[model samples]
Target: MAFTETTARLTDQGVMAMLTSAVQAAGASGQPQCIVIVDGSGVVLASFRMTGSRYLSLKSATAKARTAASIGAPTHTLPDHAKAALAAATGGDVTGLKGGLPIRSGGVLLGGIGVGSGSGEQDETVARAALAAIGADDI
Candidate 1:
């Protein structure tokens, strides 16, 4: 039996690139955003809040990142009926917000990214930009 398994993870440089892309995307959209990134285990790796972004959005952004990492899918794909229960069960560590997307490379799960403080579509666009910047698979 194998004692361990190989897994993909995001590097610091990749994370930074993603962050930069997200910030630029948010800026181009003219909507300030709170951004969060987490590893496959849901540990936060990086976060940023743009100037003039809603302060409270940080919380939701974190939850969104964790949720996407935990589920290996986009937060918006979560069933509507299970949204509240999932959030409550996880003590707000997870969310069904539209801005979270799992980060993958070569079909392997690496992490997740979440963006907030904008419309759902805008937030998603920023997250998608981040994923694209790193050549990660789209969610």
Candidate 2:
């Protein structure tokens, strides 16, 4: 029986690059943001709250990152009916917010990125820009 498998993971440099890209995107949108990145195991890798960003949004951003990483999908894809239940069941660790996106490379799941402190569209745009900066697959 095969008991071992190779896995891809995000490097520190890659995380930094993604963060820079997210920050730029948020700036371009004229909205400061709270950004979170999480490993596939739902462990936070990096987080940033830009100046002028809403402090409370950091909580939702973290939840969104965890949710995407845990599910290997975008948090926004969660059904509307399940959003509340998922949040409640997970003690708000997972969310159905639109800014969470899975980070993948060549079809391998690496982690996730989440952004907040703006409209859903703006948040998503920032997250997507980060993924693009790292050449991650789109969802």
Candidate 3:
């Protein structure tokens, strides 16, 4: 008898499929967007932004993805908790913004995704789509 151990990855094709869907959805609402995907160590693996996407979205998306990776929690969850924990630390980098999500496959932390340029809710929708395309569990 033998047991097989499979490897997992956040493939470029998969990531693209997800981002494209998000872009389509966001664009439908006439909103440009920036999307980011990073590994567990806060390394960026993929990113894209529509021409009209707000310039700030690039940095925000990157930051959100990094935060999710570094904190090992969903982007949506950390902000409120960070607020209580940081209190005075709110102004700088770690703002309680949404649209970041960690990528986990078979209980392993693969990476994370972040979106911006639209409303927080819209950004989150994009992130969820990306996660799904990459075959990850949990939002």
**Roughly what TM-score does model 3 have, to 2 decimal places?**
0.79
Candidate 1 whole-model C-alpha lDDT, 0 to 1 = 0.93
lDDT, candidate 2, 59-99, per-residue tens: 99999898888888989999899999989998999899899
lDDT of 1 by residue, 14-132 (tens): 99999999999999999999999999998999999999999999999999998898899999999999999988998988899899999999999898898999988999999999999
Clashes of 3: 0
Compared with the true structure, the alpha-carbon lDDT of candidate 3 equals 0.76
Model 2 residue 90 lDDT?
82
lDDT (tens digit, per residue) of candidate 3 on 1-139: 7698666667777667777876777787787889888877777888888889998889888878877776767776864655545525644344457887778877787777788898898888778777776577875
Compare candidates 2 and 3 on TM-score and give the better one.
2
Candidate 2 has its poorest 10 consecutive residues by lDDT at 63-72
For all predictions, the C-alpha RMSD in Å is 0.8, 0.8, 4.2
| TM-score-sorted candidate list, best first | 1, 2, 3
Off by over 4 Å in 1: none
Which sections of candidate 2 miss by over 4 Å?
Answer: none
Against the correct fold, how does model 2 do in TM-score? 0.97
